[model samples]
Target chain A: MTTITQGHAAQDHAHDSHGPARGLSRWLFTTNHKDIGTLYLLFALVMLFVGGGMALVIRAELFQPGLQFVNPEFFNQMTTMHALIMVFGMIMPAFVGFANWMIPMMIGAPDMALPRLNNWSFWILPFAGTILLSTLFMDGGGPAAGWTLYPPLVLQSGNSLAFAIFAVHLLGMSSILGAINIIVTVMNMRAPGMTLLKMPMFVWTWLITAYLLILVMPVLAGGVTMLLTDRFFGTSFFQAAGGGDPVLFQHIFWFFGHPEVYIIILPSFGIISQIIPTFSRKPLFGYSSMVYATAGIAFLSCIVWAHHMFTVGMPLAGQMFFMMSTMLIAIPTAVKVFNWTATMWRGSLSFETPMLFAIAFLFLFSIGGFSGVMMAIAPVDFQYHDTYFIVAHFHYVLVPGALFAAIGGAYFWLPKWTGHMYDETLGKIHFWLSAVGVNLTFFPQHFLGLAGMPRRIPDYATQFADWNAVSSVGAFLFGFSQLMFVYIVVKCIRGGKQATAQVWDNPEGLEWTVPSPAPYHTFDEAPLIK
Target chain B: MTTRQDIDPELQRRIRRNALMVGGFALLIFVLYIVAVALKVAG
Candidate 1:
């Protein structure tokens, strides 16, 4: 076994050998995967606030439900921009950022397979984000048609429409490039003996995610571009009078959209798989099955896009096909959840921040998953469609599901990334606030949806008052608590107790074999794996 | 004393090929968009 002294000494030697490039140009011109990864992550953290700020505006507007702070149009703009920013800007990029940082290290690679392209991918994002955010300040306000960018409604959005489409194109291009980088790195760059099955779960999930991104991102680009032409070029692809079908747009968008949901969460599955085993001090219960389950979910994600369109007047046959396909996803997803629980069962489990968040993810994401199955029932969906319950369902999936894994991942690797220990007490505080705050915010919305409160409205009837108020308070608590998260990240990066090479005791991967704050360049000579 | 600057030629070839393929696929998306616009929808 490698001793702690040896770990610390090796880290010191690495630091002396390869000090980082100095100044802003280092960031601008650097193709080092670690530097680029840091850039992607920092950008995403900033956007989390930018998007979260927009959500707070939305929650505050819905606080009293009587046109309190902003007009209905502006309220619509807030909701629209919020979802676009959070999905395209925050969650998706955050996972990609993690992929960039972790994938090369986890595999025994010196750098990403395409280092220059990796730099290009990270750079495009900030520009795309700028264009999207700039729309809010434009004359007609941001694309108020909602993030779904549904036709006729989105077509009605003024100059902002073109900008939104262009932004989507840029974001899609960035993801596609990042996906290619990941695919090439994993496929070609592994050490000689690190066979496919011997690779880490994180690498496996990302390889699958990269495939999903390449397949679907262009479809989204195509759909949004069609919307652009329909609005600006006098093409009527969505106009009923001009031989265009509005329903056709929905089909195209959701084709990319539903798989887009899995694209975000699949990496989280990898992250959870890694964290659970370490804390449980056990090998993952079913490594091969976990991989198969991910592939199965990706396959199911493709056929089940039509579930989102159940209310759009498809034929009975169409609705039944979609409904059954959607339900089938629960099977593979259950295998994943069961595998995680079994990994934790009766092992030496500890509730450090990462494990706590992972455990929370299992329960809360399941709540989202369960509610999703409820929506899959075509007959019952008619009652629940477009209600706060639908909002509640997805938030449970995204916030605790994707975001929890993201936060846990950061905590899991922060020591390695910064080469220092973060304040454990503060990390726990952030997790509890987020856990309780997220539950408080979305749990009551389920009741409100059942109580017949529709979403995306600026005002509501007096009857839905209590839950809306409770949810708003929770939103503020959740939003502000993230500041604590930012503080923890910054404080750790600056300095703290020096970390050992294996920051955690039992993470079995190439990443832990490297020193904390890994060398600017690593694995020049690949380490041997049995 | 091989430094990080010396990348493998075989790796270089693979990276070049993959980059071109991704570029080609991106071009195909634009082609699909044009087809989407030109094709007349069924009433």
Candidate 2:
């Protein structure tokens, strides 16, 4: 390894171009994986605040439950655009950012296999986001058909539908390109002797995630194209009045949508898989099993899209098949949960900020999962569908599940990325406040949903007043606590205690083999595998 | 300090071409949608 480093340094100095490019062009045209990753992370952070502000408006309006804030149309736009922005602009890109930064280093590659493509993939996001956001100021306001963008309803969604459709196309293109880059990088760029089984869990999870993105994003593109034609080209693919079935649209959407949920979370699963072993001081208990389980979950994801549409009046046999397939996802998911627990069993454990979030993710995500299983039963879904209960279930999964893991992963890697250890006290405070805020925000919605408060509505009867107020208070707290997160990140980036080459002593991956803050060029002369 | 030649040019060229193709496909989707909308307005 030392010889490899020395050789690379000699070669690097020969050309006098080992460092990142200077100024704006560095971000605009350069293909350095680390720089591109930084751009992605910063972009996601901005979008987080942008999307979070819309959520604040939403919770504020729902607080008193009589349309006290924005009008219902604007409220619907907020809901629709908020989901679109968070799912596409914030969560997906953030994970891709993590991939860009971490995957090459983990696999001992100097850069992404396709650096120019990497650059192109990232640059598309901001443009897509801009188009999506600009629709709000347009004459008819933004797409207000909910992020699902169902036909007829979406067809009536003012002029903003075209912008929304185009935005989705661009976003999908960005994701597919990014996925291709990841697939090619992992397959073709790993250092000699770093075989598939030897790769980090994060890399494995991302490989599966990229495949999921590739498989489902196109379905979305196709489904939305059909909707576009129906709206503008007089096609009746999804219009019941013109011999087309609206339910067919739901079928197409969820086929893409269900896997889309996993596409968001599987990377979080990978992050947690990486963090648990580090904090617990154990090799991941079921590495091979975890890999197989992730693959199984991905396969199951494609089959169970109809579980989301149990209320759409499918035949009894169709309902039964979807319900059972949905429930079967629990097996692989549980295998993962049990494996994490077993990895932690009787290990020398310490509650660092990242570990704390990972543990919270385990408990809360499982709660979400159990609720999902409950909803998977076609009979029970009749009661829960389109209700606040459904809202509670997904928020539990996304907020504490994927979002928490993302934060935790950021904390875990901050030292390596910035060459500075974050403020431990501040990190813990951020974690605790976020945990409390999240519970307060989403927990009561379960009761509200069971009590028949439908989702996507701005106002509800007074019967739902108390819990709504409680949830609103929680949303405010959660929203405010994230400011502390942004502050922590900025403060760390500006300056902190200089981190060591190996940030966490116990973790065994190629990333730690490089210097803290890494280098402009890493693994240029590949290290021997063993 | 590795020079430009140290990088894989063939791979880079392939990625650049493929990326443009994907970007073009996305552009095609946008064009098709705009045409459909325009046709609706015109007809």
Record all residue pairs in model 1 with backbone atoms less than 3 Å apart, i.e. clashing.
none
Q: For every candidate, how close is chain A to the native chain A in TM-score?
A: 0.97, 0.97
Candidate 1 on A434-507: residue-level lDDT in tens?
A: 99899999999999999999989999999999999999999999999999999999999999999898888767
Q: Residues A309-378, candidate 2: write the lDDT tens digits.
A: 8887889999999999999999999999999999999988989999999999999999999999999999
Q: Cα RMSDs of all predictions?
A: 2.7, 4.2
Candidate 2 residue A156 Cα shift, in angstroms, is: 0.7
Query: What does fnat come to for each candidate?
Result: 0.34, 0.00
Q: Residue A513 of candidate 1: its Cα lDDT?
A: 79
Clashing pairs in 2: A12-B1, A12-B2, A18-B1
Distance (Å) between predicted and true CA of A332, model 2?
0.6
